[model samples]
Target chain A: MKGQIKNTLKGLMVDFLFWLYLFGCLYYLLHNNWGWTVRNKFILITAMFFTGLFFLIGDSLGRKSFLPTASTNRKWSHSVWGWLLVIVLIVTFLVGWNIVEVNPYKFFTKFRNAGGITSGIFDPSIVGYQLSNQSLEELKLDGVDQEILEKLSGIIGKRYNTRKVCRDDLKRILDEEEFRIYGEILLSKTEKNMTMLNQALTALAETIFLALLATIFAIPFAFILSFFAARNLMPHTFLGNSVYIIIRTIATIFRSIEAIVWAIIFSVWVGIGPFAGMLALMIHSIAALTKLYSEQIENIDHGPVEAIKATGASTIQTWIFAVIPQIISPYLAFTIYRWDINVRMATIVGFVGGGGIGLLLMQQQQLLRWHNVGLIIWLIAAVVWTMDMISAKVRTKLTSM
Target chain B: MSYLLEIRELHKIYEGGTHALKGIDLNVRKGEFLILLGLSGSGKSTLLRCINRLIETSSGEIIFDGKNVLQMKGRNLRYIRRQIGMIFQQFNLIKNLSTLTNVLTGKLGYVNTIHSLGFRRCRSDVAAAEKNLERVGLLEFRMKKTRNLSGGQQQRVAIARALMQNPRLILADEPVASLDPATADSVMRYLGELNKKDNITVVCSLHFLSLARKYGSRVVALKDGEIVFDGLPSEINEQKFKDIYGEEAEEVEIR
Candidate 1:
């Protein structure tokens, strides 16, 4: 009992230290700039809202089995339904706090005027000059006082007429100013929003497509490569050794670089956007897949391969019948796993302008609009988490079946 | 009748510098049930593998059906393999696939790459697999995953798969090693029947002397990678086995 307690304490200490070190490193990376911003606060609120929503749905649906359970039977926490209720309560509290305190609406309407018109000199001056010139021409045609018409024309030239003027002309100038300012703001917002959305979808599509293509292309190639890699398959030592070393080196080099760094490098060469992201993902995927597929090939039962070869089955035929079948499950599982990782990484690649949710995230941060940033982050997190769960479920089903 | 396989001065050195088969010579006649007997590390498995070119010989020539199997390449190698079948100790069936799919792998050489990768097989190939599974008395379990079957049942599925190849030669490398004694007996009986009924040449390696005596028409004994005795099974007496096996044979109780 004493020894067990000591061992447990040691393990706990190690775990604590590891987490502490991790958090410390993270703190260093983010530094003192961890103060709340409008965008981050908005994101926090949104995350809390969705988390609460899921929690409530989970509680109402009685889906406690999905969560990890505690060993001890503490009535409320022990049962799945009880756990769901607790989670729902916690999420609700957090969300309520965020909504009340963070106030996402403040960020949106901060620059907006009370009348929904943007108060700015440039737009009004342009509109006023145009309107006053037209009014002067009308007055001249009507043969009004020469001094008044002259004053209006001179004021329009200076573009600083701020008098009450007639209600019709004033209304027209106000409408024109509002339309110009709102149009510019709306266009900018829409362009940024659309680019961000398009980048994310394109990156996701390309990553998945390329991952599938790489899986197909790499499987047979890796099988053949494994033949050379496994000492048992080759006849000569020199050839097999050389081939193994070459493949090993290539795989190592490709896998060594982080996907984000790869995206940055490719972005420079390809000139930014989703194309760069796709190429980066493809390169990393090939390396990762080749290693996984080759290992699967190496570990297969030699008896069948030998049997096929003994029958005078060609190398290709032996691999097809004997080796390929044995490794199919792991190969597929790995491919799916890599694809999930690629999708998640593709989002981050956008930070380097390779296009995705990360690009939107950067823009929101730059603009100091925490609410939009929060929205994008929550969306990405939810997508990644859901995909992870789905992939895991699929892998389990495939392997089990 | 002309011999189906001839090995002259066969040698194999493993990567670990172990001399597995040292200056070995053997011949296998067509339609013969040959058993190779030896203790662990005696090179019986190596000799069996060398015949199929599964384990390439360090220095030797293996002539099969009058062609040098060592020098054969590409299409020729595949053509030769199509005529040979193999069974393993672990059954080596694809665990995720159904028994029928595992059996269908035997006909992979005949299918095109596109169809094979696409999971499409010729109708006749599927029919043949079904028939082979029926012959092995596992047709009822055809759609079941191989991993779900008992060890003996899995081995039967493997045999059915081998049979689907329509092989002329079958090399079993410790096919019964992982099985219970009863299952091993049944598997051996199946092999014996296959040899007699199909006129297929069979070379099997066995650890048990009784099994070898019961099934083998000819028994070849190896000691330290060298062929110590090669004769009719009846000629392998206690004294003769002792002489070939040294002091180790004394501990072996032949049932």
Candidate 2:
């Protein structure tokens, strides 16, 4: 009789907690203005009712008892351990979604806006704007309207300056699709676009060079630090082990901070340009390469190390003859791979005044110059693709050697 | 009464509590080729390693050339290591290095490590490396990497490397364990020749009783980390063999 009473009280406690938690969550959602309104109250209650039923059924399944007595298929309730966890996840997901107030309509709008912007960026306007009077005569021969041709010549005579024509004047002249001939004429009248394109190309060169310089500069420091950081080399003695831990900890802390954050600090240090970008990349690569190279050291065959030591070689002698030969090939391979990674990151580092194609891209994007942005994007893609191919080939060659 | 190496009550309890060597006490004469006979885990490897201080002993006294090897640190330890050469079952030559370079590395104890890194060994160093390689009959293959050599040839290259040390003592830890019958004999022959020709003290461990009988000037048998028999190869009678091997073992397998 006592055991039966205790069982009843335990079941009652579990059921009470489950129901209370369910109701409390619903009340909190309503109180927080998520669904307490008259129109959404019905939807909210319906959702709550379904969830409540799911948990109630799961709880009954957990206890192996039901309102009417579940039948032959009730064997599933024997494994009630997994049910509570599933219900908890479902409840948390629903409550969290409600808390965040995710709207499908708003998500769809964002998707649509992103699609429109992507389309605009891909549609590069390559029409030249600097047409001579002789080109206007040629336009006339192509059956362009006489008045539009005259307006076109006026644009060319002004050396394609937007300042020469009012905003409304230029827009009106190029407004109609039929007068796209004149639009082409206006396109042929802009010299400024060509200069912007030239600048983007030059900035792109700087970005590539910056990444190269960073990786190159990082190699010497990273190479030296790797030997100290290697657990096998340094952890043999207490002092060496402490040095290993210290170097490893510092490298990890630096690795956690992204290259851009480093770039920001370096831009302040060296004054914004490719040099600052190179410096930031170099520092980040040092931390990254130290970790990678030391792991390489740890994985090398210890047989040669022992063999060298048995020859009665000194500490540095063991490293020079045994350790150095094993690592040189892998070191070259990793450096090439790092150089490839740096090139891709170099573009973004430019946004913080670290001077690269990315800086011009930031400006062009903000100014809504989709044509210039398109040009920069294509150029960067080309450079990165080339680098990827070259680095892969070089890495294979180096490692294989 | 005279000995080149003296070991007293050596104990090696590994970190995880494996008593690999339990109070080993032995002595090695200056020019004797001593064979250590034991089953697997009989502390041959541990005892050999402790002499070189490759694995630190738990407690012991290992006196080599009147200097206590157990108490050595830094340069003193290295100096002693230079006098005693060691070869493993794996041959342990840097695989990517040429046969000559592998042999040249044996002289690393004498040259500055930084200076050695330049790949430009002095004329005498080169001549010595060549001489050692020739001694092992691998002079023709000096330019080839050790990885390209056969198991027997690689072992010989390793022997040549040990010779570069002009080692006063050579510790061979199951050097022929990995080789087939004929190849094992050839490798053992090189060690035997080195022992007789140079009068270098040799402490070798071997699993096969036949190799022990053929090569050992004196044999020390270990059973469960303690010396069971210290005598000549001819003295190991059938009953004695049973005590050393711990079972009724056939002479056929002993080969």
Candidate 3:
């Protein structure tokens, strides 16, 4: 009789708290962001009714054994606290939906426009890939006026008529001849894939060189810094400890920043080109590779180190005889892997004016030339695929050795 | 003046306050095979390591060849290490390295390391490494990696590497502990041969009394970091063995 009376008091307190929680959620959601409207008020009331029903089931049937094999004293989902949590989650989702201002109507409108723009870019870019005029002839448009072509050609002038036209000249030429080629593209016909191929090859070679040079430049510095960062190699003195800590902190800070940010910093420092991109890639690789190399150094068999030291070898000689032999293979493998990573990063860094095929990609993006963007993307994908194959082969061979 | 190596009250207290060795005093003459017998944690390893400065003594003095070993620094310390060879229970061979390279490492202490970095080591060093390999009867296995060698073979390779140091004193810390009885006998045979034929003073730790009596010219027994007996191996009867090793120890033979 006394336990029954206590249970009734607990039920009354739970009922009061549930309503208080609902009221608080509704007040927070409405007062801050969403306005106090009848629709929202009705939704909150319905949620509260369900929450209360869930708790009633928990109190009335939680202790009853439903299965002969199973013995459970309580149901977590049917409990008052669980029901309250479910209602809170639902309320949070609704509030977040309102905060994001998600409007399906605007998305549909832009979604339609996206189709039209994509189709337009696709048509021109695919046509640009065609080397022969056979496709253009099938368009059946009349030939462009020679007089108008002369006027546009004269604007480009003889001096600017080189195999690799300067950027400013190309822009001027494109502006003048864009309308001319709009029709001439339909009328003209011939094999001139060389120009486009040359441009692509140049940018791709530059990207590979950028990654290669950066990794090469970073190797020696990273190798030297790794010894300083290795805990066991560093002396136990205060000065030695400080040097280790400083190098570790600096490498971590450099590693934490993205390669693109480093590219931007270097681009400003060295003027927008591949040199800046190389510097950016090199700095980040140094920090990253040093950490890897140092860890490898730290984990090697100390038995060999002790053996070497016992031979009366100096510190440097000990490192040469014991440490270098153990780490050389791993260091080389890491370097090859880093080059693969740098190759991918080079393209992204170029978007920030670091120089590579990414520069062309950015240019095409800004000009709304999505077809050209697709072509550049394909170029980067090809490089990545080849690098994957090469790095894998090299690592396998190194491991076998 | 008769002593080649002298220890005057060497005390070693580890960082966690474990007194590993308590005021050990001993003297070793030139061209002697002295065996240190002790149970586990009896300071045999600590005493050997302290002699080489592998582990620092908390407070003590060690004099080697009329020079204060505790006060030696930099080049002086390395000079002493060059003369004192060490072998571990595990053999401590760089397992992945070729047996030849492992032997060559012993010469690293004597040579200028800068010139040895590339594939071309000093030509004479190569010849000397080959000579040491031949001395151990492992010249045919010189190109093979040490990991492929057997336990006794690996210990022999370790001996060969030590021979390259031209050490006046060799410290063997339970060198046969990891090997089987037959293999242990062979490794011990090699150490004994070096002690007898080369006239190298050896300070070695051992567990079995049979090997100690056979090879050791003198025996020193330690119990709880204190010297319990320091005399000829023949003098240690069953009573002295019971006192040094606790009364509970069962007498076990190694062969």
Q: List TM-scores of chain B, every candidate.
A: 0.95, 0.97, 0.97
**Candidate 3 at residue B198, lDDT?**
95
Task: Give the CA lDDT, 0 to 100, for residue A225 in model 1.
Answer: 54
Which has the higher DockQ value, candidate number 2 or candidate number 3? 2
Docking class of 3: medium
1 versus 2: better lDDT goes to: 2
lDDT of 1 at A313: 46
lDDT of each: 0.68, 0.81, 0.80
Per-residue lDDT value at B240 in model 2:
86
Q: Model 1's CAPRI class?
A: acceptable
Best by lDDT: 2
Name the better of 1 and 2 by TM-score.
2
Residue-wise C-alpha lDDT for candidate 3, range B1-255, written one tens digit per residue: 378799999999998999998899999999889999999999999999999888889988999989999999888899899899999988888877899999988887787666665646778888988998888789999999998999989989999999889999999999999999988988899899999999999999999899999999999999999999999999988999998899988668877
Poorly placed runs, candidate 2 (over 4 Å): A1-28, A31-81, A95-112, A115-117, A120-129, A132-197, B117-119, B248-255
RMSD of 2: 7.2
| Interface root-mean-square deviation, candidate 2 | 1.3
Model 1: how far is A272 from its true place, Å? 4.3
Clashing pairs in 3: A133-A189, A133-A190
B93-202 per-residue lDDT for model 2 (tens digits): 88887888999889988887668767687899899889888888989999998889999999999999888898999999999989999999999999999999999999
Span of 10 residues, lowest total lDDT, candidate 3 chain B: B112-121
